[model samples]
Target: MVYDTVVIGLGPAGSTVLYHLAGRGFRVVGIDMARFPRYKSCGGCISVKVGELLDFDISHLIEHTVYGATFTYRCARMMDIISDEVVGYNIMRDRFDHHLLEQARKRGAEVVEGLRVVDVVEKKGYVEVECDEGRTFKGSFLVGADGASGITGRKVFGMDRRRSAVSVTAEVPYRSEDLGMEIDGRLFIDFGSVPYGYGWIFPKERYLSVGIAGDTLKVGGRIKDFFNTLVRGHTLLKGLRIGERVGWTVPTFYGEMPLPVKGRIALVGDTGHLVDPFLGEGIYYAIKTASMASSVIGDAIESGTPDLSTYGEMLKGEIYPEFTSAERLSDLVYNHPRLWYRMIEKEPEIMYRFYDVIRGKESFGVFYRWIWSKVRSKPWKVLRRWLESRFLPA
Candidate 1:
């Protein structure tokens, strides 16, 4: 069968692209290895900006709305940063992805579930995708939104190397009556507690999603130990009962690599490494990138260009700057743990301001200038903290 565009992996990115293209009267086909409502190992938090981009009320799909967050560092300094507005939503990936895919199908997209794309080949005019079930599909344009280990990136783009981090997450069905709320969500990022990684506790309706992430290459068998420490040792969620324990890999590091776009092939979302390194959040970015790719590809098709050369340039211009800034911030945080600790300890208000920037409530320029002034004002204190952090082993 021939399609105007063949999108592999019907996750947020793929499904979003399909929704936009199909709604615009394009012949789109979306394929996924698994069926709808599949489980994905993710933090499942979406910023308020995502709701604006989707142009729909996601409040129904959201498990809970988080007004603010509590950030805890290794120096025993914790800050409860409250926001005037609802900053984010905690969602389950299974339900969220399925809902988006269904919306695409409702708009006339041909969705093929349980079809694993085993091989892809670019021909003279179109790209061919072969599934494990011996079905061959053809499309003028191809989009790869599979994930970190995307087949489209490896086979089509030839950029096979990916830097990844391991994360172990467990969602427990436990209620905290003492909290006096249906949901109390907090993001705990402990540096020295877990090497090169951080722990998190996100609350849902009647469940709590707890997890930890780090460089798996450095810590071999200690992943389980780290998870235990977060649940057992942490004061916030010490007595939570375990329900379903899930673990997965997140690609945290990305360099200035070329995108997976050739004559007729384009990559979106994780396939193109569009995730934010500092926050490990990709849902909003993936949806936005997929929307951009759909518009560009649809235009290329209608104009008879038949090529996707400009896709890379568009992505680099629109999305790469945010990812670059996030990478730099991630490096600074991971490199100087004690500076992060002291900053939270001395002036906890900065953490709330930082969270505002993160949730897009405030401009990055304002946040950066404030932090820069602090560093310039106390250079000696910052240097002393860095030196102190160097001696402390992870």
Candidate 2:
């Protein structure tokens, strides 16, 4: 049977697209290579703003809610950034993704698991998805929600390739009663270990998720060593028993690459390169892009003509501008991190504003401009040098 929409990948983006499609009374089919409750390398931090996007409750998947963060630089100086309310929830991806897929299934979407999509072709106004299991499915439109390394957008639709960051994560099970700083509901971020990236410690229900990330090409052989040093350097996590170690590539949004919507095919989430450039976060962006894709595709299907040409326009109007601000801010913070550290040290309000952005109380676009405006009048010699260092090419 021909489906109204064919979704590739059953992660957050693909599954949400299927959910929305079925909710709109359309026939949708989702395909994925992995079964439900599969492992995905992620920090699994659920931002507070998630409630604004998804109407359902996910508290069952939450292990803990963190309201504060400790920022450590070179494992020496430290700063405590606190929020009035809960900042975000730490979760496990396997259960979280499985729940989302189950939601789609309950909404009348057919899920084809354990089947890899080998090829996708668009002909005669329909997209044909051929699976490695010697079968094919046809649909009105196809969405490539498969991840950064997935074959859909990169191979089938021919989207332009861009540089991606490499990250390594380990989940460690440790006794909560160990003598150390508070770990119940706090987030730890260390910036001294990796260049152009940071190390993070998020507390799950029964484990601590620790990881480090940096520019792939620049960090190359040093990533593993850096990750090892991050864990060893932290006194709280130094002696913990590691339960799992995994690595993955984050498709960071730099600028405009090839457009995601092409004729009868569209790409969502990592396949569309929607991950944030500054924070290396993709789950929220994945759901947002999936919502956009589903709305556009659902309308296209109902109109008896699937016009997906406006998908890029919607992204340009909504999501792409924020990415532009994030990229500039990333260049500033990553290139001259010591300068930023010093500035934040002097003015703690800067970090509060960042926390506000994470809480969805402020916009990154405005925050970046506010930072530039404050730095426009530089008095100190060190400040001038920092600006020159950032502006001048190395």
Which one wins on lDDT? 2
Model 2 weakest lDDT span, ten residues long: 385-394
User: What's the residue-level lDDT of 207 in candidate 2?
Assistant: 80
For candidate 1, write residues 1-394 as lDDT tens digits.
6789999999999999899999889999999999989988887889878886785556787887777766666425556666666778889888899999988999999999998999889898899999986998999899999987668876677653436567789877765674533345454455545666677878777667788877657556587788877677666665557666676767553675767577888888887767777777889878988988898899988997886767778777766766776666666666565677667668768777777876777755566567768877989978887787778753
Please give the CA lDDT of all the candidate structures.
0.77, 0.84
- Per-residue lDDT tens digits for candidate 2, residues 1-394, read 7889999999999999999999999999999999889988888897888768787878889998988788877564777777677878888999999999999999999999999998998989799999996899999999999988788878965655446788999988877887377776678888757878889989887888889888887787588888888888776786677556787888888675777888888899998888888898888889989999899999999898868988889988988888889888888887777777778878888987887787788888999999887776674765876777567532
Candidate no. 1 TM-score: 0.91
After superposing candidate 2 on the true structure, give the runs of residues whose Cα lies further than 4 Å from its correct spot: 159-162, 379-394
| CA shift of 35, model 2, Å | 0.7
List pairs with backbone clashes in candidate 2. Answer: none
TM-score of 2: 0.95
lDDT of candidate model 1 versus the reference: 0.77
